[model samples]
Every structure is written in C-alpha cells, then in structure tokens.
Target: MISKYPQLFEFIEALLPDNFSQSQVGMSGATTNPRLVAQAVLESPHQWSDYLTSLSGRLTEAERARRLYDQVIVEGARQLHPLWISSRRTLGWLSAQIEGGEDMDERALVARGLQLARLAPNVMIKVPGSEQGYRAIEQLVAKGCSINNTFCFSVSQAAACLKAIHDGRLRAQLQGVSTERARYVISFMIGRLGAQEEFARQASQRRLCLTAADRRWAEILVYQAIQALLRRRPTPARLLLCSLKIDTDVQGREHCWHLQRTGADCTLYTLTPQIIEFLIRSQQQGRPVVPANGWVQVPKRVLNRLMAIPYFNQAYFEGDLAPADFASQPAFITASNDAREGTQRLSAFVQQTGDGAARPVIPPASDAPMEHWS
Candidate 1:
C-alpha cells in the first residue's frame, strides 16, 4: 500500500533532526544539561553502568557527576563529528554546560568554558546568558572558541551575544588567526512564552486572555525581528530556535509549519525526542502539513498589542532587559526556580551514588590573545 502521507521521518530529517543525516540540510545539534543526563541514566541504567564503574574509585560525589556529564557530551560529540566536518565546520556541534552552581563566577566560567571546548573538536561550550555569562562568552569567542549562549529569553540578550561574537571574531582576525571555524548560536526559548501567556489567562479568568496562538505569533515576530537585524550586519552567529513546547493542536501545527517555511539561512531548530515523535505521529495521521512559502506577516494590530506588554517590549526592543530582569517576570522566575530545583535534585542524586574523586581543576586562562584552546 502506497502511503498517501509524506515520509514524516524524511520531512523532519530535512528540517534538521538533532541526530540525523540530511546532506542537503545543515544537521542541527543537541544541547544537554543535568536533567537530560539524569533522564537518560534512568532510561538505560545498564548502558551507563560502565561509565559509573569507571568513576567508582576515582572521583568524589560531585567529581563523579561531572565526569559522567563529560562522558555523555564527548559521546554525543563523536556521533555528530561527521556532520561537523561535512558542514565545513558550520554545524554538528554539541553543547555542554558549565556544571557549577548558578552563582558561579565569571573567571570560573571562562576557565570552565575553555576546558569544555577542549573535550572534543565538535564541542561548543554552553554558557548561561547572564551578565557574567556574556563576559565569559566575549573572552572565549575572542580566543576563537565557539559558544552556545543558552537561557536567552529576550532580544537584548540575543543582541548582546551577537555583538560579543562580532567583537571576538575581530580580535581573532587581528591576531592573524582565521575565524572561519568559530561558530556562535543564540538560543531563543519559545514554549516558555506560551506557558506564560496561558498562565496569565488563567490567573485573570480569561480577562487578560492571550491564547497560545497569540504567544506563538509573538515568538515568530521576535525571531523575524532578530533575523532582520542580523541581515543588516551579518555575523558568524546564528539564531537557534529552541525550548519548543509541543502543541498538537491545529494552531500549534500551523505554527510549526510556518516556521519550517521561513527558510531562514543559518538557523537551526533543536527539538526534543518527544517533540520529534509528536511531529511524526501528526504527519502520519494525515494532518495537513503546509510548508510556508515565506515569513508570516504578523498584523500591525497584533504587533502593537504584543508590544504593550512590558516584558514583550523589553524582549523585542532590547531595552533594559538585563539578566537580572528575569527575576521580575513571572515566566522567567518560574523557569529559574525550576532549573535551580532540578540542579539541586541532580546534585543530591550524585552525592548519594558518586565516589569521592577530586573535582577536575580548570586550568587558568592562557596569555595568548587568539590561540585556540585545543
């Protein structure tokens, strides 16, 4: 029986699945944190047993957890190495976050970022989009290290990251080093905005009614605005669409289709396995999957309405939305709380099972201006 449906897997692979090959398309990469690692360990304990055994007598509780994290990142990088090479150093980069507590210092972040970048050729260090994070990103990029600026929720954050990348590339150029190999990605989290809109609706009993569709529109606008900005002054940095919330509804599917249509160059989507599965199921069920021909035009009225929201304005306008601004917004506050709690839980688990190997010491920053760490 010839299936009338499009080959769902192929369609998604063309859209850049996290770990799949599609020569015509730039293969997207994966980003991992403690939560993802913990889930993986639970799903396949036997698979990770060897990793644990290797650390059993050699490391402390925290040190063991850190080693396990690095192992996972290195393995992932190996898997994506071909994509990295095939893209001529453009794609196929895996991101590993600095595992220190949230209050980790800037100097420590720079040291840690340098250490992570050395783990594998395709590894890009994931740094938080905080003030200290931006500073660290500037230092690393100036030295020719690729970076994934994570936890970005605003245009201000994204713009700041791009500026850092530009400045760093210039520094590398001046030092007689080719920056063709440096890659920078600014991750904009989408689903969290929808969640925030939904919560506001419920809290006001629909009086402050903003549907998920509205939030999705807002996200697209933000992305379009950022792309437009990038076009004016091209940089090595690319925008990564991430933290997508899976919505199986008609509107949700339409939003996804629209994004696929944008055909924005240098952009990548990092989707979770569950979301990929959802897309496959949706396509198999014969749901219409229309490809967008061009960027969706958000109506002026809608843009005005979105801009009326202080958070939306700050995010879109890149005005005064400092890293600390996250605490003042409910959506960001919730995300921060969730991350802190998750890290604490993961820490407790590590403490219980980890052997006491000494923590890995990050070497001090090198004196060379643009020397690649590796």
Candidate 2:
C-alpha cells in the first residue's frame, strides 16, 4: 500500500507508535527490486526462452553468470530481514539454488556467501544439512559467519549441524576468536506432516503402524541432539520449530496443548500471525489458555513405532531427503477457518498437579481471569 500511495505512509506513520521501525523506513526508501529479482528467477526456469537462448554461449562464461546470479540472491536475502525470514522463502530459495546446482558444485556459492558476510553482521547465510551445505556452513562459521540450518527434520541432521558448530568452535579456538550468538540455528519443521487431515488420519493409522519411528521427532530428538552436541563441545545452536500445522489444537471441548508450561529455555516456536491473533481474541473472550504440564515427551510407544517404518531410518535423514521431504509436510491446512470466530472456551487446566497417578487439576473457570501464559 505504501508503494502504491506514498502519502499513505505518512498517515500510517502517524498512527504507529513512535518506534525505530518508522525511523528506518524513512531512512531506507523502499522499492520493488527484490520482487523483480524474484520474478526474473521464476521466469528464467521456463518463461524466459530468450534469456536461455542468449546464455547458451561458452561453458566458462555460463558458469560465471550462474555464480553472479546466485550472489544476487544471497546478497538480497542478506539485506532484507524479516521479509524473507519465513521458512517458506528461505527453504524455497535454498531448494531452488541447490536444484540448479551442477555436478554438486558449491565452490562459487561459498565464495559469494563469504563476500556477503563482510557486507553486514546482521545478515545470516541459510544452508541445509546436506554434505555440500554442511561444508559451506563450517567454512563460513570458521570465518565468523552466521547461518540458519534449513530442511532439518531428523536427529542426524541435528548431529551434523552440531559437528559443524563444534568444528567451527574448534577453529575459532585455534584462531583465538569468539562468537557472541549461535552461529547456527537448526530448523525443526513441525506440522508439515501433521497438518493434513488425510495424512493425519493415514499417519495416525501409520503412527500406530510405526510408532517407534515417530518418537525420534523434533522435541525429543532435538533435546537429545542438544545434549549430544553439548557433550562434545558446546556451541550456541538453538532448535527452532517452524511451519506448525496445528496453529493450535484449539479444538474439541478439549484444547490440545502440547507445549510445556516450563519457563522459557532454549527451544523456540514459530507461529503464523493468524495464530497470534486467534490467541489474542481467545484471551479477550475469557477462554482458559493454559500451557502444557511439560515439554512434549517422546513416548516409548512412539519410539517403538518409528522403528517399524521402512523409510524411517535415523541415518537416512542425516543426508538429503530420502522419499519424504520433512520440510514440506505441514500436511494439513490449518483448522481454525476464522482465526477470529464464534469459539468455544479454551480447555481447562489445574493450577496444581494431584498426588500419585492423579492428573493435574485446573482451577475453576470463575477462579481465574485473563492473562498471558508466560
């Protein structure tokens, strides 16, 4: 809207709280260049016959051109924060880049990324846990590079990342250098498979079939992976949950709350704005929004089930995707048709847990009022 009607920005600015955001927008003028680059890439695949025709020159020249194009993308992502911060964009960009890679060539990509690192400290290089990307991650981090580990679903991916961090930390130690924050963030994409009804139904049935394999998912695997990494050599690496399928199991007479009520720790959860709005509205309506008793536990039954699945091998996931790409699975569409709608009250929770096998008890609806969980 601001791009179409510049005057509207003035009004919008006035309405916004006096913040640093407004100041930045004023300082750096906005343009549609990034969109054009995106369009160019999209068009290049099948739409731009002329460009393809024009580029069919010597092999040496073509390689240089490809490197230049990849640099543009890396730098563009570097400059634009939050705009392309979503896993979808980051994942898509990384996917497309790799799909276009020839003969497993990562030499040029690494060089370009290294150049961009010198450009800005806030910019983060995004890579996957693949052998190629892993190598790039280590080299970059060694040179004080920050990176996001995209497309990680299994523990092996986490293990590889942990090694990369340890290796970087070792290199830094040798060089007498230090990093302030986590040089790498392992992205644990959830909801991809759990989102779809058919898949969920099939998977639920499948879960019963392969419950053992399912136990090795994000929370448990990541928790264990973190411990494994910390044991070798500690490096700041956080597990970020993304593409959550259950924006909220804010359903049935019983709202399914999976997150533990434990105080904030290393774990991170990412939700769409839609979910945030829904949560806000729910609180307004006096729904009981309670956090879980503890972080979701990977049950022994689930661990056993995971072992049954033919393709659920933990080692296979350490490399590129086998048959299923975990990053793309948020199988089901979100449940809440209207994030804001006539809704039932939230599931009840007890202020205290009961003794022995007794479950925790929720306070009476009348006893408590509205408030943020944490």
Residue-by-residue lDDT tens digits, candidate 2, 217-299:
52344444444454565567766655433233335332222233221345544434333334444444567444444455556
User: Which candidate gets the maximum lDDT versus the true structure?
Assistant: 1
Report the Cα lDDT for residue 204, model 1.
Answer: 55
Q: Backbone collision count in every prediction?
A: 5, 25
RMSD to true structure for each model, in Å: 7.9, 17.2
* Model 2: lowest-lDDT 10 consecutive positions: 345-354
Model 1 C-alpha lDDT per residue in residues 19-97, reported as the tens digit of each score: 4633526345667765565555444445555567766585676676667667777887887788778877666778877
Candidate 2 regions off by >4 Å? Answer: 1-104, 175-182, 193-233, 247-264, 287-293, 310-374
Clashing pairs for model 1 are 59-355, 59-356, 59-357, 60-356, 60-357
Q: Candidate 1: global Cα-lDDT?
A: 0.64
TM-score of every prediction relative to native: 0.80, 0.52
